[model samples]
Target: MIPLGGAAGRVAGLVLAAGAGRRYGGPKAPVFLGPALRVLRDGGCDPIIAVLGAGARRTRAVVDLAGVQVVDNPGWAEGMASSLRLGLSTAARLPEVSAVCVHLVDMPGVSALAVARLLAQAHASCLTRACYDGEPGHPVVLGRDHWAEIIETTRGDQGARAYLRRHAGHVTAVECGDVAGGYDIDER
Candidate 1:
C-alpha cells in the first residue's frame, strides 16, 4: 500500500496492457502484467489502474490482480487510444489523483527506479516523460491540467505523441537511461 500525500502530490499509475499482441504470438499481458504492477506499486504510485482487453480472462487466470484496479477496455480493438482514454478518465475521477503516470506493459525494461525518477521530477502543471539517452519515452507523467487535452487529442496507437510534440516547451524530460531501457517487445 502506498502512503498518501507528499510534496510531489498524489499520482496514480495507468498501465496500458490491453493490446492483443498480434505479433508476439500470444497475449503479452500474462508475461508483463505482474511485473508491471509490481513496478508501479514499488514506485509509490497509488491506486494503479491496469487496462485489460485482449485475453482478459486468460490474463486474470494467470496474473495476480491484487492491489491494482483492473479496467476492461471494451473498445481496445480500436487501438491504444481507447485504453489511454479509459485510464485518464478513471484517474480523473479520483479526487486524490493530481497526476497520472502512464506505462506500457510491453516495455519490461522500465524499472521501478526509473518510475521513481519520473515521479520525483514530475511537476504539478507540466508534463514529464522519462528519457533514455536524451530521447523521450515512457513512463510519461501527465498533470491533471493536461488530461482533458490529451484525451481529446490522443488517437489510434499514437497515444500522446502529437500533443506532447505540440507542447514540447512545457514538457520536463528526466534522464533515466542508465537505470532502465524503454524498448517495446512488439514482436517475437
Candidate 2:
C-alpha cells in the first residue's frame, strides 16, 4: 500500500459495491469489482476497502480480494448510505488514512487516470471529485475532516450528496473527461 499523499497524508480507496443492481439483473460488484479495485490501486489509493452487500457470497467466491480489505455490509439492503458509512467507519480506524477516494462499482467508464487526477491534490481536508464537461461524477475524494458530518447527513441511497451539496463551495472539481468517461451502467 502506498502511504504517500500530497502535503503528507494517506488516501484510502473506498469501493461502494453493496448495491443489488436490480436493473442490471444482479449485483454488479462481483462482475466489476476487480476493475474497480485496479482503478484505485493504479490511481494511488492505499489500503483499499470494498463493501459488498447483495451478492456478498457470490462476490467473495468469484472475486480476488487478496490485499484489499473486504467489508461485508449486512445492512446493505438499506442503501448505498450504509455501505458509505461502513466503509468510512472502517477507514476511520486507520490512523494513517487521511482521506478516502469513493468509487462506485457500476461506473465502468471511470478509469484509473480519473482517480489519479482526483488523488493528485488530495489531503485530510480537501473535498475533490471528477467532473465530466462541468458535470459532477464519481470517484469523490472525501477528506477525513468531513467524514463525521457526511456519515450523519447521508441516508438511504443518497450517499454523500447532501453533504457535498451543503458544502459545494468548498468542493474542488477536477476535469477528467479528457482521460475518462463518467457514464454509469444501469442496464445489462
Candidate 3:
C-alpha cells in the first residue's frame, strides 16, 4: 500500500476542457468545468490546469473559473491529445508536480471520491487509471516518468490510449465504478 501524507508526493490536476463538442452542439465547459475543478481540488490535487479551446470565450463568460489555471490551446481542434499535451506541459513546468491526474470536462459523473482514490494510489513510477466495472477509464494518474512518452505517442483524439496500451503491464487499474460513473457527455 502507498504511504499516506507528505511522502506521497505532489499530484497536479489536469482537466481537458478544450473539446469542440461538435456532437453536443455547444461548449461543455459551461456545464462541466466547475464540478471537475472542485473534484480535483477536494481530492487533494494542487494547481489545477484547465485547457480551453473551441468556445473558450463563451466558456469563460459562462463558467465561474475562480481558482484554476486556465490555458488556451489554439490547436484544440486537433483533438484531445493537444489538450492533454498542453495540460501535461503546463504541469511539468512546476518543480513540485510529480504526477498529474487527468480528468475530462465531459465526464461530470467522475466524483471527487473517485479522484481521491486515484490520487491516494498514485506513485511516482506508476500509471494509475480509474476503472468502471473492470473496464479502464479516466482520471488517469500519470507519473512524471511517463509524460514524455505519452506526449510523444499521443495523437489525434486518442489521448494516452496508445502509450497506456503499450505499457499496460505497468498500469494499476483501480475500481472506481462504485464511486463514480465513467461516462462521457458527448451528445445532447
Best model number under lDDT: 2
Error of 1 at 121 (Å): 2.2
Give the candidate number with the greatest TM-score.
Answer: 2
Tens-digit lDDT track for model 2 on 90-166?
99999998899999998889888888888877888989989999999898999999999888778999899888998
lDDT of 3 by residue, 27-111 (tens): 7887888888888888888878999998899889988888889999999989999999988889889888888999999998898
Clashes of 2: 0
Span of 10 residues, lowest total lDDT, candidate 3? 1-10
> What lDDT does candidate 2 reach at residue 1?
28
Give residue 103's lDDT in candidate 3 (0 to 100): 94
Clashes of 3: 0
Better of 2 and 3 by lDDT: 2
10 residues in a row with least lDDT, candidate 2: 1-10
**What TM-score do all the candidates reach, one by one?**
0.94, 0.96, 0.94
- Can you write out model 1's per-residue Cα lDDT over 17-83, one digit (the tens) per residue? 9999999997799999999988888887887999999999999999999878899999999899889
Listing every candidate in turn, what is its Cα RMSD in Å to the true structure after a full C-alpha superposition? 1.9, 1.6, 2.5
Candidate 2 at 2: error in angstroms?
10
